[model samples]
Target: MTFRPVKATSEGQFTIEGAGVNLYRAFGFHKPREFDPFLLFDDFRNDDPKKFEKGFPWHPHRGIETITYVLDGEVEHGDSLGNKGVLGKGSVQWMTAGSGIMHQEMPRGNAAGQMHGFQLWANLPSSLKMTAPRYQDIQGSDIPEIIDDDGTKVKIVTGSFWGKRGPVDGIAADPLYLDVSVPPNTRKVLPVDTYANTFAYIFAGSASFRDASTPYGVRVEKEVNGEEVNIRDMSGNRTLVNFDTGNEIVVNSGPDGVRFLLISGQPIKEPVAWHGPIVMNTREELMQAFNELNNGTFIKDQRDH
Candidate 1:
């Protein structure tokens, strides 16, 4: 089994969104081709309520799907479709803004005034861009969590893993979203689909995703008697690792262990015409979407054929 190599790595950047929510953006806007079938990923995890209470006010989104996963607080959301709900700790909400939708998300911290979560925007192919909008809210209890014999824990948010399937299905991209935690000083190798684009976002602790021959912090490798030596440097918090084409991934956890989100999906391989929250196939289509929003015709009923 071939292991995927690290193509690039980043700690992302800090940004404020909505009315005034402080968050870290791992990737978005600048390069669409680099992460196909996925547009934006924001880590809105905060300890201070002041930085996240305002939350994401009413906004418009089209031609994309937004996946919000909460780990330590509550997120109350409402959309133009009259769908309203609250996402609690370990809960997930996947919303599909097929044609158009005005949405709002307000965060309420836990008892300790800690709010932590992530929001990922997935692009919809041109064929399904105008389809009816939908929502799949899965509670933390409903999602499957697997514990290995060696203390490795994995939460299957979407797609199948280790002979178990997640609760949410019928997604256009057929993505795999996993929350993984590896034991300290352990070496783990996970299998992945060779055809899918894969990446991992480390949120806690440190780990080495590259081979022992070429550890973290160093880009090049040196041959030590033509043998691969175990010299791994750990990648700490907020590290984003993008992998090259392969069917598996190798990870070596540090002393404190490591927790991260391992995500992958099939590439759409289409031209992206993006403008803020709206994404389309062509510039003309993008313009028309804004034009419709201005004329009060953006949101459509599911009955539209």
Candidate 2:
């Protein structure tokens, strides 16, 4: 019953993307290998429509998969393959940019100009790097949610949790993605694969991770009767909690409760050569991708017109 510890903490900083849309990037474009099988994560949650309405224009992606989960508002997307659709609230779009594909995502608020969503980039192994592109759009209603007697609600987005399987499957990494919420002062221990790399991103409220010996620069909080007795005062939003080799994760919520995304996956354990939306095994492959782009051959398969 080993517990995962907090490896590092990063504040979601202000950033601009998608035709100048304002947002925060939790991790991306730098330190590309902090977490294996996971490259980038962006939080595009905003209250101002002008800040995010322009949205991400037609962009090309290759050798990776992009998972977009919307919490509030609708994201209308269309691809060069002639695939077009809108992802309403709580819907998720898992797109595999195998060879290459150009697409655009435009966000429209749900009445109050409030848009909230997250986009996470998962790295594909070298074997599947150039596979055919695909898309799996799962609506909120289709996703299964589990509620515990202790007031903990878990929305399983990918993989299985609490004996229920998620809709998004056939992923190379076999990741477990869950949106978890725990009531104030409640403690919960979530099962995780012993071999997978696990992490949690706190988006709302505060919580204390396992009460193990803190890392060199990490502050520790003492516990009494299985509760955080000496709560630290420095916790903030967007904190990244990295766990060691463990089978379960323990979390204790603060007064306002805690809401976070718990994600874990099997590491690729290979060298990564990343450039923008494309990620490959070496620089030569990256160069080849760019060459194809310049030669107008990036999109390997053109969907039936």
Candidate 3:
């Protein structure tokens, strides 16, 4: 099996979004080729309720599909489409801002006054850019989780793995979204579509997207679970590992284990004319979208005859 090499790595940067919600932006606004069809990934995990209480107020979006996964707390949301709901712990919301839509997401902390969540934006092919807006609200219990013999667990969110299908489907990008956790020192090989652009984002412990060229093996002077230990080619928390073309990936967990969100998607290689949340094919089209928004005509008919 061909193990895809690590194309690039980044520790991301801290930012504030949605009023005052502190967030760490993994990758967004720019993913030229290898990460095509996927635009943004924001990790909004915070313990301070004041940091997130302001939450995202009213916002407008077009030409993109946003996926929100809540690990703790709840988000009360309402959209111009007349949809309103609460996305509680472990819940997922896949909202397509096709044509145009205005929405607000208000986050309320859990009983312990903590909140954690992620927001990912996937680009749409030009053909489906102006399709009707849609929403896929998946509960935490409804999402399927598979466990392996070595205590490896995978929470399938939007794609299939090992004969089980994800809950969110019917999309133009055809993506695979998974949450994986491996026990300490465990090594696992996972298959990914050779053609899809894939990435793994480490959130909890440390892991090595180990290949033959990786430089990790013995223990080092690193603190782990109250002890100093070794980490073999381990990528620590809040890091993003993007892979090159191959059918599979290999990972080695550190002493504290590793938990991450792995995602892949088919690329849309067309010209991208982007302005804020509105993405189109040409610069002229982008201007048209904003001009319409200013003229109060942003929402399109979206009804196919």
In model 2, what lDDT does residue 21 have?
81
User: Which consecutive 10 residues in model 1 have the weakest lDDT in total?
Assistant: 212-221
Q: What overall lDDT, based on C-alpha atoms, would model 2 receive against the true structure?
A: 0.85
Residue lDDT tens for model 3, 1-305: 88877888889689998789998999887745557889999998888899999999998998889999999999999988788999999999999998889899998889989999899998888888889998989999999999999999999998889899999998788999999999998878899999899999999999887664553334476887998876455688899999999988888888899999999999999888887878888898889899998999997765322
Global lDDT scores for all candidate models: 0.91, 0.85, 0.88
Kindly provide the TM-score of model 1 when superposed on the true structure, using C-alpha atoms: 0.93
For every model shown, the clashing-pair count is 0, 0, 2
RMSD of each: 3.6, 4.2, 3.7
Sort the candidates on lDDT, descending order: 1, 3, 2
Model 2 stretches astray by more than 4 angstroms: 212-230, 302-305
Which residue runs does candidate 3 get wrong by more than 4 Å? 212-231, 302-305
Instruction: Compare the candidates by TM-score and give the number of the best one.
Output: 1
lDDT of 1 by residue, 1-305 (tens): 78798899899699999999999999999788788888889999888999999998999999999999999999999989888999999999999899999999999999999999999999999999998989999999999999999899999999999999999888899999999999998878888899799999999999988665554424435569887555446687988999999998988888899999999999999999999999999999999999999999999877322
**Per-candidate TM-score against the hidden true structure:** 0.93, 0.91, 0.93
Off by over 4 Å in 1: 212-231, 303-305
Q: What order do you get sorting by TM-score, best first? A: 1, 3, 2
